[model samples]
Target: MNVLLVGCGRMGGAMARGWNGAHRVLVFDPMAAELPDGAERVDSLDAVEVEGELAVVLAVKPQVFPSIGETLRPLAAQGALFVSIMAGITLTGLGDALGSGRVVRTMPNTPAAIGQGITAAVAGRDVRMGDLATVNGLLEPTGQVVWIDDEAQIDAVTAVSGSGPAYFFRFTEALAKAGAQAGLPPALSMQLARATFTGAAALAGADPAELAELRRQVTSPGGTTAAGIAEMDLNHAIDVIVQAVVDAAAARSRELAG
Candidate 1:
């Protein structure tokens, strides 16, 4: 398959790097940055003169979509499948701008840079089964891919998976700080925090129940874990943290919609 990436910024560059061996890739970025050894780099869309059986990946900022949209309208009309990685832009919004029916809007997190990201995508009204198959093939190199039927759910997915990593990182930082306050050396505290969260995440992945159940199994009356749980549970700290994150992200998603 032939793939053309419109922007070679962080996300686009990551996708190019990850998908290198899977397809014939061409990158169109004005900066003239280095790409994978065998990948073709075109300075601009005008420099890209060939077209046929192409999958166009749009990694440009949402603000630039209008101008780029006009430029890409012809390509879309010519039968190229459009896949957008811009956040907050709905499939309907993209379809209106690109004048194409075969559009897929994807919300991919920064972890995609390391081939460990999770992406949630929703197809536009004009997307066909073959188009979706092509998209799945193109995204296979990035990480796990999920297709959602409802476009509205993309915002919630964005909140949960897209912003989820940063939340964990913050928790890790707090864990390290707490450990230091409790008397562990700073370096040791950080190391333990990292290891503990990593192991817990792995365990959670292996288990199918709610995380609260896992916590219960590890807690015993009059134990250190129980005391810590008591402190954490006081005044519904966990619920407040979860609601704060989800609400902030969902509101941001709505703001981006405009």
Candidate 2:
């Protein structure tokens, strides 16, 4: 597949790296200093050339769309499948801006840089099965791909999986701080906290058990794990905090769409 990737920033660069030897990728980002092997850099959108089907992956910032949306419309008119990974950019908005309804809106986390991210995608009104299949093929190299029927769910997906990585990182930082407060060396506390979280995530992925069940397995009736879990759950503090975080993110997503 031939791809035109816009804005080779962190996420765009990650996608470019994943697609590098697999597909012909043309990237347009004057600010990008370097690109992965097998990905060619284009000076401008007009410089892009394709013989067959083209997949234009938009990984630019949501705020940057307005400036380049017109420039991308020509490609969209040529039947290029548009896949947007920009946060809060709705399918309808993209379709309107690009003058093509064959658009896919996706939310991918930072782990995509390592080919372990989970992406949630929703098709625009005019997207056909073949277009979706092409998108799946293009995105598979980065990580897991989940297709959803309604675009409305994208905000929640963004709040959950899209912003989810930072949440885990923050929790790990907090855990390390707590460890330090309990007298462990700061560096050692951070090392343990980071490794423990990553190891637990690996176990979660390897095991088919439900997350709650997995937690239960580590929390004995009167064990240290149980005590920690109990304290965290006091007055449903963790639950409330998580809910608030997701709600705030989702709300901001809606605001961005407007």
Candidate 3:
């Protein structure tokens, strides 16, 4: 497969590295200082020419698309499948801008930089099964790929997984602060919180048990973990807070798409 990656920033660069050796990659990013190995940089879209099966991965900023999208119509005309990782860019918007309906809109989180992220993808109306399969192949190198039927669900995905890592980081920060207030040294508190959260995440990934069951396993009656969990659940506080955060983020994602 020949991949035409439109941007070479962090996420773009990561994808290029993943596709290295398996596919021929041509990147077009004016601001990229350097590119990953096995990826060739093209000065302009006009100079890009691929002879075989091609997939144009739109890794550019949403704002940058309006300026360069039409220039990619030629590739669409050449039957290239379009896969986008730009947040808040709808499949309809992509089809309209590129003059093709074989577009797959995807939202990948920051963890993709480390090859542990999960992406949610929705295909345009005219996209074929083969095109979707091709998209899955291209995205698998980054991490997991889930396909959704309705494009509207992408807003929620953007709010959840796309913005989820920051939420976890913020919780870790708060946990560290709370530990420091409980008499631990600040630096040591931070180290403990970070390690604990990371370890829990790894465990969650490896364990096949239900999350609620995992919590049960950790919380014996009247245990410290149960007491802490009780306080966090008082008045359904944690649930309410998390719901608000996801709702606000989803609303903002819709606003940006509009």
Top candidate on TM-score is 3
State candidate 1's TM-score.
0.91
Off by over 4 Å in 3: none
Number of the predicted model whose lDDT against the real structure is largest: 3
RMSD of each: 2.0, 1.2, 0.9
Compared with the true structure, the alpha-carbon lDDT of candidate 2 equals: 0.90
Q: For candidate 2, write residues 129-234 as lDDT tens digits.
A: 8998898888887799999988889889989999999999999999999999999999999999999999999999999999999999989999999999999899
Candidate 1, residue 60: lDDT: 86
User: What does the lDDT read for residue 243 in candidate 1?
Assistant: 87
Tell me the lDDT of candidate 3. Answer: 0.93
- The stretch of ten residues in a row with the least summed lDDT in candidate 1 is 43-52
**Each model's number of backbone clashes?**
0, 0, 0
Q: Comparing candidate 2 with candidate 3, which one achieves the higher TM-score?
A: 3
Candidate 3: 10-residue stretch with minimal lDDT: 132-141
lDDT per model vs. reference: 0.85, 0.90, 0.93
Clashing pairs in 1: none
TM-score of each: 0.91, 0.96, 0.98
In the range 1-258, model 1's lDDT, one tens digit per residue, is 778898888778878887777788988877755776567987667555554688899998888777778788877877888999998788878888888879998988888877778899899888888898898877776788999999888878888998999999999999999999999999999999999998998899889989989988999989999998888789999889898889899889988987
